[model samples]
Target chain A: MKAPAIDKKVLYAYLEEIKDPEIPVLSIIDLGIVRDVVMNEEGELDVTITATYTGCPAMDMIAAAIRVEMHTLGFKKVNIRYAISPAWTTEWMSKEGKRKLKEYGIAAPDKRFSIPADGVECPRCNSVNTRLISEFGSTACKALYQCNDCMEPFDYFKCH
Target chain B: MSESLINYTLHLADNALILGQRNSEWCGHGPVLEQDIAITNISLDLIGQARSLYQYAAEKMNAAAGKEHPAVTEDTLAYYRTEREFKNCLLTEQPRGDWAQTVLRQFFFSTYQYYLYQQLQQYADTNLAAIAEKSLKEVSYHLRWSSEWVIRLGDGTDESNRRMKEAVNELWRYTGELFVPAPYEKELGIDPGSMQADWMKKVSAVFEEATLQVPEKIFMQTGGKTGVHSEHLGYILTELQYVQRTYPGCEW
Candidate 1:
């Protein structure tokens, strides 16, 4: 018996259920890593994803998650493609996603031109006394910053 | 006309590829979840560098050969080549001595790569410049991570400091391979001599900050660029090339 066909809209909804294992607050779709989804003429499903960082360890797990999700949803012919060019940038992050990141205590990347090289405003306290501790944070994509006002160490999503 | 450009590219690629493979071996064995993720992240970055370099090499070879799709893609060139044909420097191919050693090797290599890529960004070749520009950002983080670990290990305790010092000493001999100019590199427009001085300065600063003594200069090990390599490379190739060698032309 042939497997049931899945629509792109339904596929997206299915994908929305897959949360980034590290940051459960953000869904893969919400993270903006899911670039595009297409159903080929032959009925095969193709999903394209761009990694937040080239060295992101999550890509493999993410791919497996997509495959497993689609399989359970009854799509047997699914292909995942990695798009490396034009590279993944923090700029692709959605507004809602940024809100979720901030809510989760991770400072979202600020407007690129607004912040000077010396420092960025504290996301928690809105204080300008924040200091740059390190360019790398807990993860490859985030920068470590300590807010003098809040006395909190937070991960700032580095603007690519 | 300079083979050094190609040799340098290959050396950089080899370091990334081999070290990446070693790090990937830690996939299921990391001491903790965060550390696992971090090591794997480094592996991914190195593999990405390997892919970029291999692709560039393939492109150059294709142009030279006048072939539509060069006979070998990066993956093939990466996995299928024999030990002697591999061009990674000796330092990267060494056994991961321990957590201390592994971190030290990473710190040393990343610091060196950071300086090299920063200089390469101003290379005469635009493509090389572009690749260097992209890699510099990644290597910068790598250097940061490594440097942090160096300080942690060196300043932590008696045992930690001793282990950190040992790691540095063991890996010191291979450090010279990073700066020595291959003949091809000298002929090509790429000159790494000045860059070597810059790299030493950066490395010394980091070492000083970590309160670790920088090893004095010693005789350097060579030969990866000339296709001669250490014994370790053979075993590395066996694992890396297994899939490609088993099923020639196989693709996902």
Candidate 2:
């Protein structure tokens, strides 16, 4: 049986439902991985995502999850393409998304392009006194850091 | 000179090749899903670096042998060689003891690589310099990640501190090899001496933050550059080569 037609708006909503497994509060759309959602005349849904890193293992899972979620929502023909160039940067994060990250205890990345030569600032207390603890944090996309003021260790989304 | 250049390149490639294989083992076994993905990311980066270095070395070998593309590509050199023929430094061959150990390993290796690549960026050879310039950025992040973990684990609770110390002690012996200049480095005009002091300064600064003592022992285990390797090399090669060995000349 042919799958029922789906609209771009509905497809986007369905994608919004798929949250980042790491930070559950943030959806792929919020993370900027869900680039553009388009529905072709054939009723097929095409989703483009930019991976945080080239070999990010989550790309496969994320793609599969998107497909499964869309199929469950009645869109069977789903195409997920990974856009490598123009690469994903922290700049893609939405303001609301940054706030969600702060609430989650992880610091939102510095929006400024001219990142200091020393290191990034701590998201928790807005302290540049912070120090990078590890490059490989809880995830590939984050680096471990400690806010000296808050005295709490947190993950900083490493700018690609 | 070319011989030593090949040797030095193999040394760099082996560290990355072996460590990448080890890190890949954590594909599904990471403490957390995010951590698992992170380790894989690091693994891919190291593997990519290894491939680039190996390809360059292979090209040099082909030129010396008066052939195009040589009889073997980088993969052949990486997988088909015996343990004794493998030239990665001793530190990379060490087992991934735990999360602490793995982080410590990354810390030490990345720190050295960051400085090494930075200096390499000035090499007279344009291709080598270009590769170094590109890799420096990636290595910088790796170093930062490793350094952050060192501080966290070192200053953490008694259990973590103890584990971090133990990990450092276990890996310290291998640290010596990083500074020993391979003959090819000198012959190729890649004097690593300038970066040695700088690397030491940065490494000590990180160690201080971690509250760990830098082991003062001067003796270092060597031989990777000369194709003499540790016992672990055999097992590492077997695992790394299994697929390629089973299907020679296979391409995806």
Candidate 3:
């Protein structure tokens, strides 16, 4: 007898438990790294993922986490496939993920490239008086910004 | 055909890795703390790109050669390759002479990559196309950032302009090697030579705004593509492969 196919809902639930190694507040599902999930002919789960950035060190950790999570979910074997086309964008980040990032003191990716007349809003003080400190930040996926009102340095997940 | 494809992929990976290593030298030595972080961050991205390409190359090599014991891996390909086996362009191996040289080198290379990746996104090879698509986004930022610096340096004060001009005179010769495709690149389906007109147009536009001249009639240097690199590559490999050479299979 073949193993029962894991439903999409259950698969997502399991994936949601695996938070980004770098941004613990955001789960891979909400972050849009989890693209698609399917069951292969052998009744084994196949998960497709895309890298947020080319050189994200967290990728390996995420893959390992997936294996561990699948094992706990009673799936003995899972195939993680990486897809790079139709490249990942900030738009894929869930609304809840953005909220969590803001609450975590890191600004979620902002879609607008043009600087508003007001300024970038600070995740901490909610003040639209922030300035870009550097085009890059602590990680390859973020840029450094400073809150003029709160005077705190923060990382902004780059819009890429 | 497959051999050419592997060589072509390795050529690109080597370009990214060597330039990334050179850029990382500015880690503590950047003109400013923020800029220092910026360059190194770019370096990380480049190295990240190298890792992906190397992984692809290694997979292809393993599949083709069917090696069993001591299976081929990205590390072995990166750390164990001889200097003559490197396929990076000569321009990437050039020393980071000064801020101007560093910035200019990045600007030129990023511009080339921007166009190259754009063309590659539609390539017949799905894997290469995917890598190009993923890389184009990061390359876009690098191009914009470096171009801005080029303008700033070229149009800045007399001293700054002098240094930028000096960099141009020294580095312009290496730019030619990028467009002249080698045997491997020729077999890879796309013609970098065809993109030269557009590349020159954008570069000229940038230099014009900066009131700088794109040196005319310089003797263009070539030969890094065929593993005929200058003295710089050996030095880079010595430091880069040292840890791996000293301790085989050392995990970081």
Candidate 4:
């Protein structure tokens, strides 16, 4: 016999507790990497997720954190799956997540398809007059930018 | 199992691996902080692409019944393989000579990858297509970054222009290998030759804008795709595989 049906909402709540290793304020749910959660007939808890970047080192860490969180939630058979088809886009990042990211002093990605060209508002001084220092920042997903208004450099979440 | 497909996958993985390795040499050695981070970030992306391709190749190799290591993995493929067994193109294995050379090399490879991924994303092979599609996004940035640098350096001060010219002369011969389809690539129905025109058009336009001359007398070098490599690959493998060979399967 299969285990009792668990609420998908409850599973989401558990998942929301797991934060991104690099970006602490955003959880996997906020990042939109958690694609689906399924309770199979065999009572396995399968979480389908996508990587922000195929080679993002955080994927393995995030997957491990998911396993630990699920275990704490009492999931005995946890299967973490990866999907790469439609590809993960910054568009999937949540509105609340964006706000949090901005508050954390990093410019959050503005939603839209194509590659991220500049026009990132300074998360500090809230100025549109920012120049890019480098297209690569501290992490793979971020790029370094400096605000002419604030004269302070910060990271911009690239539109990939 | 389709051996040719597996080899093609390995070739793709190896190209990314070797190029990533070369780029990573600039991790702490860059002229400026931003440039250092930029090259390192590109290295991360390429290495990440390599990991996905290697995993796909490992799975294909293991699917057969008579495999020596039934549990072969990406790690084994990357760290255990000898130099002659690597199937990366010669251009990727070339030494990262100087800042100008690195920029030019990245420009050439990223330009090739941008077009290559565009083609591969439309190909019949789904997994390869998916990886290509995903990589296309990152490769676009790489192309932009490298292209901008190529122009900046080539069109910059007199010293910068001279260095860029030297880089172009030193590196031009190795690029031909990218268009030369290997035996495995031919078997897998991927034509490297088909993308040559597009690649050159983009390169020539960039060179024009950079005020640099495209090589007129191109004596194209070949090999590396078929496993024959420059001496550089041996040194690279020695550095990369040192820990793994010394203590097999050692993990952090």
What fraction of the correct interface contacts does each predicted structure contain? 0.22, 0.14, 0.73, 0.78
- Ten-residue segment with the worst summed lDDT in candidate 2 chain A? A111-120
The 10 consecutive residues of candidate 2 chain B with the worst lDDT sum are B126-135
DockQ of each: 0.20, 0.11, 0.71, 0.84
Candidate 1 accuracy as TM-score: 0.72
Q: For residues B104-213, could you state the per-residue lDDT of candidate 2 as single tens digits?
A: 98888888888888777777666566656656656766776678789989988999999999997888878877777676777776665566687778878988988888
lDDT by residue (tens digit), candidate 3, B49-93:
898899898888888887665577889989999999999999999
Enumerate residue pairs that collide in model 1.
B2-B188, B3-B184, B4-B184, B4-B185
Comparing to the true complex, what docking class would candidate 1 get?
Answer: incorrect
Tens-place lDDT digits, model 1, residues B1-252: 634556666766787899999878777677665566667778888888887788777666666666556475787779777787677878888887678888899988888888888887877877667667777777767787788888888888899999999998888888887777777676775565666777778778877877889887777787766677878888888888988899988987
Candidate 1, residue A131: the lDDT equals 82
lDDT by residue for model 4 (B105-135), tens: 9999999999999999998889999999999
RMSD of 2: 8.6
Q: Can you tell me the CAPRI class of model 2?
A: incorrect
Count clashes in each candidate, considering only residues at least 3 apart in sequence or on different chains: 4, 8, 0, 0
Candidate 2 vs candidate 4: which has greater DockQ?
Answer: 4
Model 3 ranges off by over 4 Å: A39-44, A114-118, B67-70
In candidate 1, stretches whose alpha carbon ends up further than 4 angstroms from where it belongs are A1-52, A56-97, A100-106, A110-156, B2-7, B68-70
Quote the lDDT for B142 in model 3: 88
- Which has the greatest TM-score? 4
2 versus 4: better lDDT goes to: 4
For residue A62, give model 4's deviation from the true position in Å. 0.6
Q: Please provide, for model 4 over A1-160, each residue's C-alpha lDDT reduced to its tens digit, 9 standing for 90 to 100.
A: 8688888998898899999999999999999999999988778899999989877999999999999988887788899988888788898999999999999998988754135555578999899888878888899899888888889899989888
Error of 1 at B221 (Å): 1.5
